[model samples]
Target: MTLPTPMPDTPHTSAAPFASPSAAHAPTTLRAWVCHDYGGAEVLELQTRPGPTPGPRDVLVRVLAASVSSADVRIRTQNLPRGFGLLGRLAFGLARPRQPVLGTDVAGVVEAVGRDVQGFQPGDAVLGVAGVAMGCHAEYCVLPATKPLVHKPARLSFVEAASLPFGGLAALHFLNKAQVRAGERVLVIGASGAVGSAMVQLARHRGALVTGVCSAGNVALVLALGAHDVVDYTAQDFTQTAQRWDVIADTVGASSFATCLASLNEHGRYLSVAGSLMELLARPRGTRRSIGGPAPERVQDLQMLVDLARAGALQPVVDRTYPFTDLPAAHAYVETGRKRGAVVVVAWPEP
Candidate 1:
């Protein structure tokens, strides 16, 4: 679908004013989904909390929609590997969450922009990732203007735009690392899932022959997303297949390093969004290998995904959307590992 061209200079008056007395008197509060002490979906509770204020280089977005990701699930459960666990504990709070909000991807209207910000102004429709300080699950979030924030594609609804940042950037960054070329074969495991589905589309867009691996139910969906082939994981072993790919994107991390390596051709790249405990343990040793490299985490790569979405070359695959009050249910769905694409949390009432 083609997106409407964005008029960046056009002023939008539909957004609620952030400077209103109602907002100021209650500046210390807003409704948000908070994870007081992380565990399962049960940990997420809707509560009133202090709203975030934009810094000099930040934009305070009135979030319309936000998404639940596997990364959020990992952090919520404290299931990350040793280093990540320590980092999370320090960065986020040692006992409870420093940033209790659990969302990363967001699509929203700019309610306010910091004094030094220039590129975006109040009322701009935008989508991007909000890293460690994840307050997107609330009514508002403050993100650095210099981060990946970009104009939202007019073709996508807020719910759809909310699904892109994390998975899209991960796919784009991994593909760039893989250096995929036209006619090269690309295999995306967990293709029906968020990151996997994104990788499939992106690899195809790069003119690579893309094969998507998913359950039988999602084969058509994967194929519709531009995959050249779809492998039903329930019916067969993709790693043992005769095909050798130039790049293998293992989104779920269900496949081991050995299995990924085995499926690759010479000088082929193996990429994954979710890292296993084993991979983290072996990182030091594998860092020097040609087959294994450091994981992708470039902010510029996120901008590239934003551009792709705006250009209509990328589209977020949303599995389901829950109201702001249903955050626990959304978290539960993410934990199940059966969601076809992204699980979005709509933060505000629709127009």
Candidate 2:
């Protein structure tokens, strides 16, 4: 349960000479799960393609593990949150996903770094988030060195490290926006999920009295994550309670400003990680504010999460892992909306 502390210096795992940016022009063939037309789990196909080449400022990673998240499901099925259907189509693709490969979180080895890149080199174990520019489902992923890429701690395996970025980054973004103060009451809906679980832990880390709302089966899990209280939504509606929180975060698209307005304190913030367009456009009734839309991708925020993970302040919650070949199965499980945390796909098992 405890990951080892990372050294201040970046860890090196291989000593081979890395290809220069110019040498990367001729890419080798690699296997990848590609989604040409989005419809169902069957849309993902494992196919052979030329490996991605790094640009002048890019870093090419040989993925060891990747996570299948709710975003992947949305991109796959076009089942977006309540009002963003047309917007999603425009951003993704009218016919299908603009990006054929769908993955966000990845833990891998730095196969090569661009000529102008620093702080990373060939053979460094690393974890990164590609965000909306999804491509981690492939054997090789190319990202800018300035993204959320960082050295993987020595103690955590590929699967464990792969679970951190997607959820942690989102939670950190919204929590920072909410400006949760110490000793304030914080309520996290969908607390058993990826973003929600990270929200609970990160809020607690910031010294808030965190309360988690989840199903009956996840009460113990949420409590173990350092929540001060747990509300089982299966048995009770959290909004119906007399209690009001300083910050209420809905991570599963379950609660809206109209529904949670009365439950919020005078100056409380309602964070909607999966909010619809109308909810995002809704005006504040009073002092209570609703914050929504996608969280911005920041390397600094990702670095903060890596530091917290190294200090044992953040713990990754991986509900299950599947072989790289079973990625379609992972997508199916995530679509069910029952996963406790990240669903990881191990491309290269740890030795």
Candidate 3:
């Protein structure tokens, strides 16, 4: 839902008293990273401001931890991939980001629920993605009960649970659309990334012969995630090799349908998780087909990811963790494009 009022364009300097994270009663205001402009990490300012109120169908959560993803970086810097510039501006904002608190994946304890909410109550540990609502990068966030919110399993901590939704959800959506089958030859490009890592594990668990293409530094990490083979993209190009795959999934914008067409086997499926505009608009040429678009944010998918994590089938690779106050540092680190897996922020530690 669009907020009724846009946050102030000026910095907030009021030192008025506000409830701490440990407070029992609901807080009228909460601390959050607010970005009023489209720029680098420097644009993000930590300020104490009014928090969002839960509507009749909404649930308010005390955010324990949240993951800083590529999506967050893109929105913050307005540095989307080529061909997505206009789309990004239109969807986000022409002058600035539509959502100032830029985070999608969240893990925390429920603090309050609207009257119409069900199956969740105050004090329940929960984890889910806010998706385009994107307010998880704060001490508290509101999620609609009908969204992807679900109970957090005891096996995963706040950070680990925070790592699952963004990557795992996208991986699950693409894999399902591709209809991956047991014993099929599957190749995941950029296998060290959030989505790639999740796809590696999920594909392996589906009994596919999974091959991961990544830099040499992430080869062992991909192997540990159950990929049968690792193609060091630094050493050689997997597409130029003689190997053919039934499914070729590009988690990063490394390869497109045209580039990987000849490398695909008969009836192969190509998944473009971060597709360029041309790639998204391109049609299937031959026996192989391509799939690309926004990944659906489904509660069922989030639940499946949680279940897989509980069963040890999905392992969330968190490369680094940052204190909530150091979220700008986290954003700077992610901007380097070197971090593997998720970059998590401790939103507010458990009391």
TM-scores of the candidates in the order shown: 0.86, 0.93, 0.92
| lDDT scores of the candidates, listed in order | 0.73, 0.84, 0.84
Q: Residue 70 deviation, candidate 2, in Å?
A: 0.5
Tens-place lDDT per residue, model 2, 245-276, is 99999999898989999999999999988988
Cα lDDT tens digits, model 3, 121-157, are: 7777889789987999999898987679999887777
Where does candidate 2 have its weakest 10-residue lDDT segment? Answer: 2-11
Q: Alpha-carbon error at 301 in model 1, in Å?
A: 3.0
Per-residue lDDT for 331 in model 2?
95
| Candidate 2 to truth, TM | 0.93
**CA RMSD of all predictions:** 5.2, 4.3, 7.5
In model 2, the runs with Cα more than 4 Å from the true position are 1-27, 348-351
